[model samples]
Target: MANIKNPIIPGMAPDPSIIRVDKDYYIATSTFHWNPAVQIFHSTDLANWKLISYALTKGEVNLRGTNTPAGIWAPHLSYDKQSGKFWLAYSHMQNMAGREFNSDSFAMWSDNIQGPWSDPIYLTSIGFDPAVFHDENGKHYVSILEWETRTGYQAPGHIVIAEIDLEKGGIIGNWHRVTTGFTTRGCAEAPQVYKHNGYYYLMIASGGTGYAHGIEMGRSKNIFGPYEANPSGEPIITSSPHHLFSLGDPDSGHFEMYNPKSVMQKAGHGSLVHTTTNEWYIAHLMARPLPNTKLNPLGRETSLQKMTWTKDGWLQMIDGSNLAKMEVPGLRNSDATIQSDQLNNIDDDFNNSRYDLRFMTPYREQKSSWVNTTEHPGNLRIYGGNSFFSQVNPAIMATRATSLNYTAQTSVSFKPDHYSETAGLGLYYDSNNWIYARLCQSDKEDGTVLRLLQAKLGDRIDYIFDEVRVPNNFAEIKINYNLGTTQIMYKISENDDWKQLGDQLDVSYLSDEGVNGEPGEVGGFTAMFNFIGSVDAHQHDSFADFDYYKVINK
Candidate 1:
């Protein structure tokens, strides 16, 4: 056996939905407020995964004003052997204000996993985390959390199921209210159904997506009835199961439940799969907050753990430990070459015709104008459009800040005629929260100058430094995000010593729990990102040329 390692996929990759099509394994995860939603990954062996494609590529959904953690929710991926088709089901969470939880569910199909998937067919808005389960008898069923609008009811509501017609849009007849869980861990969601010998199993995420988060299960003889909880009444897997706390907490960031002993936190929302070797593993979402802080800058990542079935028809971790691990046993004699750890640093020279699959832009539908690689030949010419504060058309190319401690650097040359036309490097969390060190209209100088700025919870703080003068046209800008603090640095030459732009900025708030200052409620779960962007509100033609982009984790 090989060491598969925990968090098979990292950095804002949450709500994993895994499926095996023939010899290949596919996992689709949620992408909130990020365009080209529903990130898809492929792996020949369970241990090594690679980002291959995205499901909603043609601007299939509009997320222009989508808020943090409110764009695309958990996406369930399935494959039908009889039809040789791939199915993806997901929720477009539109609003979270006042806890309305207004969302719409839809499903799409593709003949190929890497595909031109069919237009989203409407599913239901009963709640989020909608999943489609295809029975052995060729019948399809949809399982979703029936969001409780009534205050006195089971707060998050029950897990409901109904036979769905994939060809059409709605359920066949009526939805049947199923079991919440074996026991009340509280806040049941992300319900996935599966079939085994003589029984249909319903697995759900419990404990409110925080420190107490875990996988809860129930089974029934029929597809949708009288389901019984696992005999233990506890979650099958979790990061913190030592004590149950915050059972009904509506907040996603249970920062109060930080487990000091655990390397992984918030381990829940799991999907299962069986390898060709006849081994079972659970793919789920987990988080790794900064040491001693409940701030999770990496957001929720995808993790895997081996499991087994009891003779009494229950699933349990192979090791009998509910705590999530940083390193887990890999597949038996699995392929190890294509793993994410293969590159500790990513250096892109803007040589490829298409942007690397790892690069992403928030709420952007790319065209030749916004981010043009051919306009300047080898340089990535980013034409400025909107400020980072807008989810609309911010001319930014960002990649996940995968490690808690890492340095992201890029070489950019920009001449901004006006203050509104600026370009440079940034560490962003959402449209509202971000830090930018860029070359903009100099307040004191005649030409463009370098300055540092910060935005916390949508409040913009500007001109942290006004003395840095860029004598050369190009500047190598870098942001060192170590743990939870961010240090901005710049140099005129690549070989020159890097100079600090401002004081070491505490960016602990660039986390899942940080900027969302809402009281008594959970915050957003989107991870932090490092980006190269240009803003030209004065005139849309102003552009920045980025020679290279690099991210190194040390």
Candidate 2:
């Protein structure tokens, strides 16, 4: 039997959309502000998952000043059996100011799950978290929340369905307001429809995107007709036990439903699939706040729960309950045979033919000019480009912080002749939030200096330690984050002897849940990334050779 473990997939993987083809299962996740968006994973067994490739790589959308948790929202993945093409639907939340939420939804198709995906085709302007359902009659239908900003409406933000004509780039028929998700606890979004056993089942995410989040279901005989809620009169899967409504409140469209008994805050936005062994599972997003604290560093990760059909023709957990977790039979090997803590290492030597899929750049395209693999055989040479704050571009490639307690170390040899060129290792949450131990040339003393700097979310330049004369040209930097606290250390050799450079920076604010503001208000969408970066603001050519980048879990 399979049991619920700690974290199925860790580190900023949210809004999981899973699909199974033959015996193979693939999962796609949302990457809000992170560039090279839409992470895809492959799995043989339900327990083990590995990074396959990213869906978006052409810089299809600009995300320079995209606010926290406001870039790319929920992404839906579906495979068309007729064309054998993988269709992906996502929402680019361009702006969320005044909580206006003017987002545009788009679609992309690829022959294979990995390769060169086509450019995005505009789908609808209808709210975020859009899903596509291809019917048996070769017709495609889309279901999404029609965000309500108008007055005189009974229930704002209702789940609407429309037939889509893929070639014409528009809807063919009228929009049907099927359900407002009122009976099963209001505030619905991320609607996915499926036809099974002569019935149409519509699953939606309801109860807001917070502690009271849930997966509500309704079924009907016709595709667009009167649907009946689950006979349980509650959510099929939810961490919250609160009776909330999204009906009367004006901003009820975006109201936060509170649930006092939630073990995992924000446990909704789910995708369903049947395994090779004919067992059903629901992959949903779940958040875990630090032990007794509300700081969630791993963000929303993918979690699975066994589900079965009820005698009343409704889907329910194996155990007749509203919560999502219970021990169930495994589809592959037994639960004891699966490893609980299996994680791919983050060590990189740049010896492969292509860059690691984990590495991602900020805003612009990845230029071969900044990084040269041909020149340095086993190393990566990163030339400084622009400061982190510049809207133009920045020379930085980073991977997500996989573990809360981990150490990232990198060796870089660079001669900083000007104040603009600097190379170092740091923890980067965003362009605004970062802390680096860098080696740069000081203009005042006319010599190379080692400095420790901290940049908050809105601040420009905030130096923690001024230019301190150390070995000027070549040095190694190590940043160790203890989850609760963070330390900056430096050394010049490969030995374990490291010297503490600056004060312990409390980085508890870097977690997704700890950052201030409401659900969609502020804070980064993903966790912080560990990176080796260089910035050249002087318009001069400077080379920084990084020997290796290694991350050790502590």
Task: Mark the regions of model 2 whose C-alpha exceeds 4 Å error after superposition.
Answer: 1-6, 151-156, 182-185, 246-263, 326-329, 332-337, 340-342, 443-445, 460-468, 516-522
Residue pairs whose backbone atoms clash in candidate 2: none
> Highest TM-score, which number?
1
lDDT of 2 by residue, 420-520 (tens): 78888887766666777888887674777778766665465546354556564777788888855788788765664787776788877666654543344
Instruction: Highest lDDT: give the candidate number.
Output: 1
TM-scores of the models, in the order given: 0.96, 0.91
Q: What is the C-alpha lDDT of each candidate?
A: 0.84, 0.75
Residue-wise lDDT of candidate 1 within 1-554, one digit each (tens)?
66877788878899999998778999999998886788999888777778899999987888888877788999999987778889999999988777888999999999999899999999998999999998888889999998887866666788899999999889999999997566556778999999888889999998887777889888899887799888776788888776553444443545556678889988999999988888888999999888877878999999998898887878888887667777777777765753554354678898888766778889877678688789887789999989888978888788887888889999999888777888999998888899999988777547767888778898989964444777776799989888899888899877899898878889889888886633345667888989999999997988999999999887
